[model samples]
Target: MNVLITGASAGFGKALAERLVANGHRVIGCARRLDKLNALADTLGEAFLPVVMDVSDTASIPQIITDLPDNFKQIDVLVNNAGLALGTEPAQNASLDDWMRMTDTNIKGLMAVTHAVLPAMVARDSGYIINVGSIAGSWPYFGGNVYGATKAFVKQFSLNLRADLIGTQVRVTNLEPGNVAGTEFSNVRYHGDDDKAAKVYDGFKTMTGDDIGDILLWLIESPAHININRLEVMPVAQTYNGLTIAKQDS
Candidate 1:
């Protein structure tokens, strides 16, 4: 399959891209970091194609979409993994720029890529879309604020897209992962405050990027007649709900 993954420079996107290529799938990766992407392409050889794109730039996306090579133009899978959480602060105290960044990437950018790809998928009637969301979409928390709201949009949008393509063979799947380790998420959220970011998964084992990547691969490789709509994965260190952390550190 010819696959397209955004935010493919690191974390889950990079993991997924590597795995797919290893399994003989051609992958086109887009991110703001051309240097890192080129590095990945070098490792994967012809299986990996790098496209420099910023999801937040509305003007640049359409042209990039059209410029895909003939082989990649008929993309069989699209992974909307290019998103971030900025500043773990309540809305009232949060920076407007942070909130806007989240909305732009998580909502507008998602829509832009989907709009550019879905039409072709619908016409082909044989493609899959995997949206990488967060458990925060369903269960909000302190400081989740706008990041949570954006993911909520992702959840509902995935469901609605599925409804709209009722008769078509196009499939939409949402993967909401919790407390993933080995990613740039915390760093981005804490705005490079390494100490605070490091504490997020300090005491416990967390899910790895490859774990989520593997789950996604399973969802796509399943029979065309079967559509796995949603899957939520959480690390074992954290149990159900608010039970996991109930301590006072004064």
Candidate 2:
């Protein structure tokens, strides 16, 4: 199968690319960092093709898809993994820029890429779209305002795609993972404050990119007739603590 993964420069995307290539499937890894993608290409050899892309840049996505080489043109699987959470601040105190950035990459960008790829999939009547969502989409947190909203959009979008592809063999799955560590996620969220990011998972054993990669492989290799709509994952160390209540002045 030919697989295309966005945000392939690091974390889950990189892990997925490596795993797919090792399993003898061709992978096109897309990201904005040419240097990192080149390094990944070197590591993964010919089986991995790196494409420079910024999902947030909606204007260029269609052209990039059109320019794909013959071999990688037919993408059997599309992993919409290019997304981020910019700030941990409450909505009232959050940066408007951060919200817009998240909206661009997580919502508009995913829609653009899916729109560009869905036609071929519909024509062929076979394909899979795996969206990397987050638990924050379903279970809200104190500082998870816009980021969670974007993921909620992803969750709903996946289901709606399924509805639209009802007659075709195309499948869509939303994978919502919680507390995943060992990724640039926190660092990016904290805007390069390494110490602040490190403290997020200080002593906890959190999910790794490999874990997500394994899940992706399983989803891809599952029976073509069976479509798993959604899968929510979290480390055993994590669980919902329920809603918080602040007592008003008495």
Candidate 3:
């Protein structure tokens, strides 16, 4: 199988790419950082093809897909993993630029890539799409703001896409993960504040990127007739926060 993973230079995408390539599947790894992708290419060897692509650039995605080498062109699996959160501030205090950037990459980019890839899958009547979503989409939290909204869009879009692809063999899944550690996720969220990022998982046992990779491998390798629609994962240390209220003397 040929797999195309976005944000493949780091975190979950990188881990998934490694897992797929090691299992004898060809992988097309796409990301904005050429140096990081190239370094990964060196490590993963010829089985992993590193392609420089910014998913947020909606106009360029189709062209990139069209330009792939022969062996990697027919993408049997598409993992929409390019996304991030910026500014852990209340909506009233968040930056507009941060909101727009998150919207561009998380919503528009995912839509563009899916629009570009789904047709071929429908035509072939065989494909799998794994969308890397977040638990924040289903359960809101303080300072989640636009990031949470974007992932909610992902969750709904995946379900709707599944509805639309009912006749075809094409499958869509929304994988919602919670509180993963050992990735640039926190650093990026905290805008390079290493101490702040480190504190998020300082003592808890958080899920690693490799764990997600393993889950993805299983999902893709499952029987063609079976489709796991949504898989929400959280570490043992995490759980739903439930409701919160402030009490005062009457």
Lowest-sum lDDT 10-residue window in model 2: 201-210
Q: TM-scores of all models?
A: 0.95, 0.98, 0.98
lDDT of 3 by residue, 47-87 (tens): 99999999899999999999999988999999999999998
**Model 2 C-alpha lDDT per residue in residues 115-189, reported as the tens digit of each score:** 999999999999999999999989999889999999999999999999999999999999999998889999999
- Lowest summed lDDT across 10 adjacent residues in model 1 is found at 238-247
| Model 2: CA > 4 A from native | none
- Each prediction's whole-model lDDT (CA): 0.91, 0.94, 0.94
lDDT of 1: 0.91
